[model samples]
Target: MSSASLKRLAVAVVAAAGAFALAMPTASATPARDNVKDKAEVIGKGKEKEKTVPVRLLSINDLHGNLEPPTGSSGRIADETGTVVDGVGGAAYLATYVKQYKNKDTVLVAAGDLIGASPLLSAAYHDEPTVEFLDMLGLSTSSAGNHEFDEGYTELKRIMKGGCHPVDGCSPAGKWKGSKFDFIAANVLDKKNKHALAPFYLEKINGEKVAFIGLVTATTPSIVTASGIAGLKFTEEVAAANRTSKFLAKRGVKAQVVLVHEGDQVTPNQSPDACPVVPGLGSRIANGLDAEVDLVISGHSHQAYICKVNDPKGNPRVFTQGSSFGRVLTQIDFQIDKNTGDIVRSSVVADNHVVRRTVTPDAQTVAFIDLWKSRTSAVANKPIGRITADMPNTASASGEVPLGNLIADAQLEGTKTGGNAQIALMNPGGIRAGLTYAGSSAGEGDGVVTYGEAFTVQPFNNLMQVVTLTGAQLKLLLEQQWVGGPNNQAFTKILQPSSNFTYTYSTSAAWGTKVSNIKIDGQPVTDAQTIRVAANNFLVGGGDAFAAFTSGTDLWSGPLDIDAFAAYLGAHSPVAPPVANHITVIP
Candidate 1:
């Protein structure tokens, strides 16, 4: 090991204590300028003393274009004590926090998922408002998350490069200006050219170089709609980041931070800030990182954590994630050596701050959100239907969720009239948010589900497709939920079935035999039986690793999934969360 590696090890040992300090509760909505020290430090008393520059990095992830304060569980985050705090995020609150923490040397960045699956105010304008929000926040750079590819690689380029939407033309807000910040992906490459979309971003702070290497999870292909990401290849996270770090090192840039769009969760009941270890891709990437790589800022699991993970040289390193939906922001402070221009690894300190609504929201951000809301309010505020209670997207042990079932039932009902659909299934991921009976901040009143609310739940606007699949193919589709199934899924992803269709699975059963007792309308489905199934086109294209859907015949396309959901809610006023008994799991 080099002298630098040995020194890092000693510093890491001391940083362990600072890592624990992150768990202490923060004062609600405390201004960053009040708490942070922005000055550089000079160590040693003699002429040998070296000066170091201080840099503050502020990060958030999975904002998902939430211009307004997210509602329900999405709006809350748990403290180290496991106590949940509510009313945490909104564009204004986030802006206030960012502004408070920002200094001349401060860099505001995002891990990924800044948009896509957005609120109607932003999504209606193809997330232009959200991009404008980021630019206004002065975000320096961000990695592209899986959701970034929702519309496809070409659309992502347009989002970063800026132009009027090819399909929607320019929104009422006016001509679209491209993002001011850099959107980079080190791992995602053009298959034909084998070149990254935007490899890495460089920032000069206080006459020192700080490099940010951006990467998305390789599993992106499995999770995202296949066609949207066509011609792009997502490489493994660790390898991509390490390779980029090496490239930067060769160029005399060594103060490196990886902004990766993949992460792991804190252990259950563990304080996100206090956990010493975590399990998942985030931890793996952090631990595997080269000694030259100073820190890892991650997202995707959407858990708030400020933890220390050992790098390859066994030197402790800061690894952190801010919880999703702008509810939390991770603050990382470090010193860069004046002579070496590399991060003082031991000087790294990280903490996760909740975007508490207690603070006065930034007036500019409030006006910005309201302006977009006005542009979309005519259709957004229209009452689509009523809901009896919250239909949360939270899934049961069997992976069946009330909202998922509701969406599947809606798709079945919508397609049955013209397409003659017998069964409907919905992917759990496609159900972004849930139906809440309480009124939104828009003042639509309780039990009234507005067009905006429905759009938030089903923002993909995926077209509904009804197709004929034999019972054998349906069984195969069910089996695909497990690890040994088609495409070798990393984990189980139980498909949500409509009320009329039911199935049972066993946890102990091996592979293809894990599922059985499939039925439609109380009748057993035989292998030779042909069933008409309804689902979004993304599923029919074999997204989420459910390849069986690709074999379906007699395909017929119909209404947008959101339209079906709205129509169903209209037909059944005050709709209730459907019983989550469509799927059963036996031990």
Candidate 2:
């Protein structure tokens, strides 16, 4: 800890907090500007002054198989979009970020979603690249996100141990590597015996005992497909955290924190143009948590915020979460009584830095990503299609995207040839990718969206399904998007229907309202009408945490989403991705 720098920082903190006080509360806050000293708890009886040790933690969540820096999406996401904040998610910039703040005491952590349903860039390389990147960045450990189980426990075990997949031929001369950090899951259970997989992880840092309890939302089984996690069960988060904290205490560790992939429930603030950063589900979890845990870091909801609130147990806990895609990082600093090893008080300081792709990559880290990049370049660079303009895929987990609409359309078009297909539906989770537009690289670039871009847009191998749904049943599916959670508002809006059909939605109405004006092929759908539709099997089997999809009638599995997309791009060759011209909610 540098005393001189701390003094300078202290002075700046006071001056900035004064300025911020003029505005009172704000959506985004800075430590220097917010003057957080007043909010901290004083330790040592305020008699003796000890130098505050600034523990800098750099964190990211939901990496979801991103290996390259900013320009990975046919160099699209690395380039441009209103929703797209540029940052190379690859390990190089991350390594640089870690090194700048890292002393022997620094901690690097992730909330969840670091793998699964990944792109060929990482998946083609068998998620080798992502693991290698994290190892290079020196991640402390991570809580298990749902995607970790996409291939079931077998693959996850292989990833942890062998660091590679059992691909017939990933390399005759190469190796698959595992991550540097341990993966802990406090709550994921095996149903056969109802036992925890990896309970919790604790470490001694700077002579202070810090405990980490990892968990995912209990409803994860419903969010992911039943098949992918058929024999496993996810337990309630708060209960799991409490139990794990007790376990750590028995092991002689006191300071406790929770790393969860679940996020908050927030609507856009009054300023729609500026993304509304508000307390999300993370906030709720913090409020309901046990007193033992001192901090909570959240993801999955994709909103950025920091707050100090009392849990249901009435113990104060500091909570923070940066938005997704490595755009920002939340750093928490605290003081623990040396004798008792209890956190006296803490201040929340955060820095949201973009992963600027054009910046020089850290040599060693860049080499790691490049080695895999060169090996997978053949499929990575293959031209998929051309988009004259951008089809931005920047919506948060709780929102919709224009690219989602386009892909849904493509699924509809490709599946409609048979008598089984009429309307196309998509799960927000399955559409894990986006198409690249022409001018997405740093400055002026190409107008052609390639096949690689389309593949990136539809990364999951979730096959497409044409199912039969009665008009009433379709309405039921829409309603499931928000029900069966701890609350009515626990989820986001359902994927919007294609232009050929339109549905009415009202937040004022309770969940599961009908698609009143439902139209298909210029005809209104009535109760007696049974319509054929295209949806992913995950949705058909009630994925998205939406249970209604479990009832799709007369199911038929067609080509997987990526293959269908390839066909759509081929037919629309040299065509701009159909812009999101239709579909609107009538207020």
Candidate 3:
């Protein structure tokens, strides 16, 4: 074996010995709360002037409040052979996997999206359960995702600082004690103080200090609700990481890692351990980082991969991401030079592991999930309606889906009670999951739809609104679905239109002219014609870059989106999948 390999093995042995010694019962038997002091004493024993230390980093991202096993496509895992494996992802299973891989040197962290857009189980209690779960898993630190600001900065602070919610008061979990982990945001700045929310977190591992810098995507403001980020500024990611690394260096900390909430898309069917052929934002950030920054962990795009991209100084550094919803966990191992407190760049290695359910689940997590499930059972189990078949949220080339169409139709019908709504448009991102024919739990029969299922489909609870828009403005809204628009979506986000609306768009046409042949009820919509449209307040406020919606007039507020959807389900029993022919795509 090479000298470097031998050195790494020795370091691992020492770390394992230290961990075993710490686990054994002693006379004093007092739990060690000071990590640095404990590590120093454990590694300081005879002939232990070793110049290297082994460190393990275990990470997960985009959990999105899935305390229970995710249903439908969200629960599946993809292997290197392009085969899909089912029945994965539950907090209990995740906890089991985390414990299996954890060692004394392990430092657990997450890139972002730990909560927000959560399922009804977690969302019912404002995601306090997820926070508790992370604390139990011993998360050391994490970055903030755009969804972290879903309820605004004050609520985010409440999540981090621990307290009863200002509005919802205390949950069944009682007064919230916030998260035990540090949430560091190097790029997110307080507009009033001109300082970062939580700039950097420092960890001392085996007598060496390591710095973790966290950052959200620079495009946070464009995607998140406007009011949620009114007083915060998200700066460029690379610059923020570079500046943070410089600051850490001045403090005599050289081992640096960046936990960013932005990531790149990988080719379909590729192995999670494969490097990208064409790098995206995550790769760009990793490649542009200063030499002092040794590693990057990313999330948001939800793609799983392990890559080695070159830094600005042409030295290769590790970059990795795990898929969303607790289905995968990334394990990164590296060696640090104890003398210099610098990471051995050549010793870094990373791999993605599937959270397979075959193993024994953590009993505590299972009971915790059951506690929340029973608490929410009364409302969650109430029958909303029935379906003839599954209404999958999967979209086609034109971006239309059975569930999206149903949601838009429901919004239009619900809003028509007070406003003359002709059509409704639903953003694709708003649809979280699909309606399965086989119900989630016991007591519910096949094809039966419950309030929990409906809530899962539309969890945002955005208020419905009706507004008047000219036919000209409607065309602009359709054009905004593609690139070169204010939102700059990576792909075309075809708005899910109600049954009355039909439109065709040409892929070959120019940006503004891509959308053509717009109509309502098979009648051509004239440029000067004004139509009343039904949509969620998010769309009306120009969320997701559909700025044309902001120009609408004669606005009228309606019911919460989930309530409207539930009422629609109850009103129309035995609902069948809507024909996916609303939007036409021209080659």
The numbered model that scores best in lDDT is 3
Best by TM-score: 3
Note the residue pairs that clash in candidate 3: 162-178
Write model 1 residue lDDT over 1-587, tens digit each, in one string: 23343333323322232332111112221111121112232334662454787889999999999989988888877866777878988989999999888886798888999989898888998888999999899888898899999898778877776789998899886777777775777677665433335556666676566778788888898778887888877877787777667765765778888999988867654555766545877888888988888889999987888888888888888988888889887789999898888999889988888889999999999988878878888999999889888888798878888889888999999999888999999998888787787787779999999988899899998999999999999999989988886587766787889999998999999888988999999999999999999999989988888889999999999999999999999999878778888877798
Error of 3 at 57 (Å): 0.3
Total clashing pairs for each candidate: 0, 24, 1
Residue-pair clashes, model 1: 0
Model 2, range 317-387, lDDT digits (tens) per residue?
Answer: 66766555554445566666666666654454445444555566688977776677677766666665666
**Better candidate by TM-score, 1 or 2:** 1
TM-scores for all candidates: the values are: 0.90, 0.80, 0.92
Badly placed stretches (over 4 Å) of model 1 are 1-50, 276-278, 484-486
Off by over 4 Å in 2: 1-55, 71-90, 167-173, 193-196, 265-280, 312-315, 346-360, 394-401, 417-419, 439-445, 481-489, 504-514, 577-584
